[model samples]
Target: MGTPFSFDDGTAICLYVINRAPLVEINDEALALHHLSGMGLDPWNPRRMTALRERIHPFGVTLCNNGALSLLTQETQLGWHVPRFISAELAVAQWAREQMGGTEESRNLAEEVEMYLRAWRPHADLIRHPRQRGISGHEHQFDFLQNDELIDVITPHHNATGGLMRKLVDVLNAGDESAPKVRVIVDDRTDPARAGIEMQIIASLAKAMPLSKLLDRVHSGSA
Candidate 1:
């Protein structure tokens, strides 16, 4: 609960406790889409994001500039706000769970990477669900931090593009010297074909690798 930031996509919340009050936020809502259907929900769609803002309004959560929900409490209320925070998490999680149809796929992929790291990268220090602000002032929430590189696990089969812009902007903001290298580890267990478009596009901005081939790439020192 005191962790800096932990993204539980299944619950659609990231807990970042700064000072004493806990700030809970939703990361990359676009991760909700699962298909390329013209009728599919963008999740980051103006309507949905707006609706989320309105929904959280009654709970007194702050609406972030990036169109996400965050619960900010006064320091004096912390001692009595535990229940309120749980309520907020449940409310947001229910709505987000519906959008992404649960995070089973990504959870499976995470487990795989975790096992591999436990076996081969035992000595490697790993930071999961890292949230960092880019030079452009935009924030990026990545899945893992390993080998000094920022890594993300994406199932980008349904996005047209916007869900990726945050990372793209983060990269452009890197400037020449401290440029961050992003690795998109995809959950290709479903259909490798579906990940092609987004993967190719993302590769132009970041490194794209499939979960199946992850061990090989890392073992070969190319990841």
Candidate 2:
């Protein structure tokens, strides 16, 4: 499917995925109490944070020295999911359909989407700026970038940096010639022994072609 909106000028969306934990091992098998209780709003409560942490101690939490130690629910409140999608227009339309329902909401949602796109049009320069970065929660990083066009997604995976980089590289590889380059930052600075897995993945890529060459092709202007 084609993007719903089009821009005569060059407008790009830069999605920045910050690695709060530049160095840490994530216990993916861990399950938080919120997951069991279905505490949608529990994250906002300070008491809940402490209590939840205590509850998950047994399962072991995902540790990221550079990242914050908090429930995933708490991170969503920071508005990090905004830049996840590539197409803002389509995102709004989809959200409108789901949240508002009915024709009136749909119409209103369309107007709002247009308004958002209109406002974003002027700020395209800022959004597309090389340094202009938008921060999002780590948990939502992959989900948000699954589909987007207006903005380029940035995901820095510290725990499994190589796995994350490989997945992102695969996406760019599958993208059309016109797809904007997606940057996946892998923090290789870690204990040599522990960093072996991630380095191994990078090493494999380097074998076929220089790391710089692979990155250049994905980020090439000709793309």
Candidate 3:
């Protein structure tokens, strides 16, 4: 539980020392590139380690042969050929951040649905998030999947609604003989323009069901 090291610009970078090897954890690409540039090395130049010493000097760290830097200690010798390693770490961290963000957003959307369902369809046995399945192999996940029903919860955002609509179309046309019944629940409190577009898309799809309406249907056991 070492105190994290962070840059002055409000971005936190977690550093862990394992077997005397300092590991840097940076989430944002811009922040990683900024730190890389601060070390006087081009972020994209993975083959050059001309500024390795200068980079480690500012943080009082020593670089190891395996490209792990030593934090707050100069016991380890600096390695000259660690540009590729740093670049790889940054790339992987940035990718992981992006993936984590998507997962978090999906989880938030599912939570919203769960809250509504708890109050309305308290006894309904439904899966919160379910894997996508169809002959199309589109890999489109749903917010809720209960029995033969596939429900997608979308924000009032135009892009979010549009994306859900595309997924619905894919599921409908997936050529699967047993495609589940598709449903969409839109948040009523969305930006007016985006909500209008969402409503229009729902009208066109002929399957737009509001959250309240869906709750009623579920409570009435007609869903």
Best by lDDT: 1
lDDT against the true structure, each candidate: 0.55, 0.30, 0.50
Instruction: Indicate which candidate wins on TM-score.
Output: 1
Instruction: Give the candidate order by descending TM-score.
Output: 1, 3, 2
Return the lDDT, model 1, position 159.
44
lDDT of 2 by residue, 106-140 (tens): 23333433333334343333232121121211121
lDDT of 3 by residue, 1-223 (tens): 2124433222355444334346343222233443433222233344333245344454444444434544433224323223333444434334323322342454576687777666555666788556564344535556676556777766565546545655566556768666567777776653555555677787665366666565576668663
Candidate 2 global CA lDDT score? 0.30
TM-score on alpha carbons, each prediction: 0.58, 0.21, 0.48
lDDT by residue (1-223, candidate 1, tens digit) is: 4323223443233344455335423223222222111112344566766766665666666546554445556666655554555455455544544444444555666667767654556677888766556564444556678778777665655542335544556555756577776777776667778777667777777788777687775677552
Candidate 2: which stretches are off by over 4 Å?
1-159, 162-166, 178-183, 203-223
Model 3 bad stretches (over 4 Å) = 1-106, 190-193, 212-223
Clashing pairs in 1: none
Worst 10 residues of 2 by lDDT: 33-42
